[model samples]
Target: MKAAITLESVTIRTELRPGDIGYVIYMHGDIYSKEYGYSLGFESYVAESFVEFYKQYDANLDRVWVCEHNEKIIGFLLLMHRGKAAQLRYFIMEKPYRGIGLGKKLMNLYMNELNSLGYESSYLLTVDELPAAASLYKRHGFRLTEEKPFSDFGKPLMEQKYELMLR
Candidate 1:
């Protein structure tokens, strides 16, 4: 049985263990499929991007927050460096962990790291289906700079990009 998700019961880890990324990919595939009807293509996209991120990861320029409860992952967020910019990627929280200030905590960490690293700009790609997440992004000063029809994730939905200029 899962314990109640108070902050004290949760461990926010910044370093990845050997199996962490694989499990994160699996969770993304499983949860997105059940909640939003995403296909294996979405899983593949996540895996591919993660591989790219790993290849170029630098502790000085990148960061990841993995939230765990009782040693099991419950949420994840990643920041990847690109030239002089950064990309906020793979931000997700388990259903039971949403609406309880966890997402905001992760976003605060992301913003602080972005500012500390002095990235000129930052952006994230997300679907319009995620209204709560979109609202969080907006509240953190990201502007919806792009949107268009998209279907690669099994269901047709509008793909959106939010960006922030930090100069």
Candidate 2:
């Protein structure tokens, strides 16, 4: 982690460092399994995505924010360059950190950064099971654009795509 920005009691880091990528993978794996009953498949998918992101990471176009409290990572969000647009990925906050306005703060920071980067639009894919997160996305001007049933993580789920025109 690098470049910490303190917001209240939480510190948000804007740069990705050694072992931080692995921490993200592990955090998602552990938290999702505990919260949503997701299996190892989800972890594998996250790891693969991280590998791809690592291979093509451009600091000028791609940004990651890691939120830490008491020197421990508790939340994170990623903004990735996608052609002329952008993609929001790997957004998660630990249960204890939710409902305290951290999500909204992180999102506001993300949108401001996206705007500064000149992205015209942004999109993200997530499952319908996370209603709180979906609500947050909706509040941030993202609209549900697509949905489909899938059993990718050893369970039936409605995969949803949300998009926002960032003009």
Candidate 3:
């Protein structure tokens, strides 16, 4: 079993390393499958979006927070720049890392960056299964603008879109 990690043992880094994306992808597949019963399609979708994020990445306009414990990734989130807005993606943490302040720390950092970067607006897409995330987004001034029931992830779910206007 993995040893317990105290909050002080956690570290948040902004730079992406060589294997970070792959590890993030693997974590999503492994963690979600066990926790939420998410299927392989969800992981595939994450990979495709991560590929797009990497391809279009701009140091000036994009940001990511990689949370590590004992030099291993435990959580992460990304803020991707769109035409005149920001898109939040891949905000995730391992099961053991939840109920802690790390997610809020990432959100606070992401929100501050979004507000200061001069984006006209910001948005993200998520499934209704993620109530905790939605709650965090709402607390950070994001509002649910749209939702549609879909099976694209190989399961019945509501695809939700949340938006925040910075301008």
Q: Model 1, which residues run further than 4 Å from truth?
A: 1-3
What TM-score goes with each of the models? 0.96, 0.94, 0.95
- lDDT assessment of candidate 2: 0.90
Instruction: Give the number of the best model, judged by TM-score.
Output: 1
- lDDT for each residue of candidate 3 in 61-137, tens digit (9 for 90 to 100): 99999999878899999999999999999999987888878888889999889878889999999989989999999
Each candidate: what lDDT? 0.93, 0.90, 0.91
Instruction: Give Cα distance to truth, residue 9, candidate 3, Å.
Output: 1.6
After aligning candidate 1 to the native by TM-score, how far in Å is the CA of 62 from where it should be?
Answer: 0.5
- What TM-score does prediction 2 earn? 0.94
The candidates, ranked best first by TM-score, are 1, 3, 2
**Higher-scoring candidate on lDDT, 2 or 3:** 3
For model 2, which pairs clash?
none
Give candidate 3 misplaced runs (Cα > 4 Å): 1-4
